[model samples]
Target: MKPGALALVTGANRGIGLETARQLAQRGAVVLLGSRDAVRGEAAARSLDPDGARILPVALDVTDTRSVAALAKRLERDHGRLDVLVNNAGVFVGATAADTTAEVTRDILAVNVVGAVAVMHAMLPLLRRSSAPRVVNVSSTTASFGLTSSGADLAGDASVRLAYTASKAALNMLTVQYDRAFRQDPDLAHIKINSASPGWTATGMNGFRAPRTVREGARAVVTLATLPDEGPSGGFFDEHGQLVW
Candidate 1:
């Protein structure tokens, strides 16, 4: 909540990301709206906090390296440090197992998995500068192997998607890897690294057939982003509580 405690959220132009930005700004944190389109990002920021100086827009396309680096440099010059990072930029092409192709899976992973890591790699330096840094990767229940293994495809009545689920599964592993990578440093150890399943949230993605709203989805992400000094890392959670890997 400090003046310099900035939080960057990718794909923040709408859906859960936008709601998360709004909530963060409401809590006195400077929210950086990282959207692929500059104009849209600016619009989202303004909508979140019109008169407040806490909302700013950063043009970022998670899948593009040039945009990622540019955003990192921009943030380094402006804030020098970042308190929270929400890698919320992702896509879901309805590719079911029966009809899903390798190309479709690759494309989905490119954005949902690789894109998230690229963003993290770009902003890690800034995050390290913070006293209480946090990383929250917005994931889904479909990513849960246990859930999927049990054939609990929550998308039952909705459009069944394979590429999307696989991408999130890869993302969960990425989250765990990041957590393990920084486990040695005591200072960095306090930096909570976790993934969360926002349930079936109604967002711009998934055609909005999801039962939950973006506001509800934003809760778990925001909570993980602003964890206390003593908080769990290398875990997946939801609005209800901890979820099995």
Candidate 2:
């Protein structure tokens, strides 16, 4: 994104989301650090930007339509436009296939998929105002059928956490679908949207047991969030490059 560009990252109170917000602000963008808890969000923003210059904290609960709309209205009032939107808010709960219930799947999907969609819709107006808008939906490689079927390392993860994996797969599909929809509208045709799998990262989600650091995990996400006009849309990517799955 251009310098001083406005960016919003959900779930920015901790983990990869916070790292992404920091990286974006470091690159000279004005970032909104979103958190469900206002107090945590404020603390995070203060920690990142003590002067309260670029990094601003906001209350945003993607699952709550009222909360999403309120945040969107505030953004429109304060920033006028948004150049980058990182849908990094997500939830993970481990459960075996047989152990997963419909309620569990629904709950996971509610945040990982539905909530992200809600945020996108709320931010569409602000995004449409940008000359080059970009949206990155933070996803996971475990969502890949190709990886699982080909006996890749994430194969086991894909089979075990049925709800989490399935929700991410659905989120990836949303990226493609949203990109296609944008193409039909001249105002949004230039908008870039993609799924960024941060890969395995040491975050609170896994009790920090994962090998990757938050900085490493946020790399791919920031890449997509700041994609150039010529960058590919509707693609799944990691830090290296475009992912086949």
Best by TM-score: 2
Which parts of model 1 have CA positions greater than 4 angstroms off?
1-4, 156-159
Candidate whose lDDT is highest: 2
Off by over 4 Å in 2: 155-159
State the lDDT of candidate 1 residue by residue for 34-66, as single tens digits. 999899888888887786598888899998999
- Candidate 1: RMSD over Cα atoms? 1.7
Report the CA-based lDDT of candidate 1 relative to the real structure.
Answer: 0.85
Each model's lDDT comes to: 0.85, 0.92
Q: List the residue pairs that clash in candidate 2.
A: none
TM-scores for candidates 1 onward, in order:
0.94, 0.97
- Model 2: per-residue lDDT, tens digit, 1-245? 79999999999999999999999999999999999999999999999999989999999999999999999999899889999999999999888888899899889999999999999999999999999899999999888878867877762355458889889989999999999999999988988999999889999988888889999999999999988778999999999998866
* Span of 10 residues, lowest total lDDT, candidate 2: 151-160
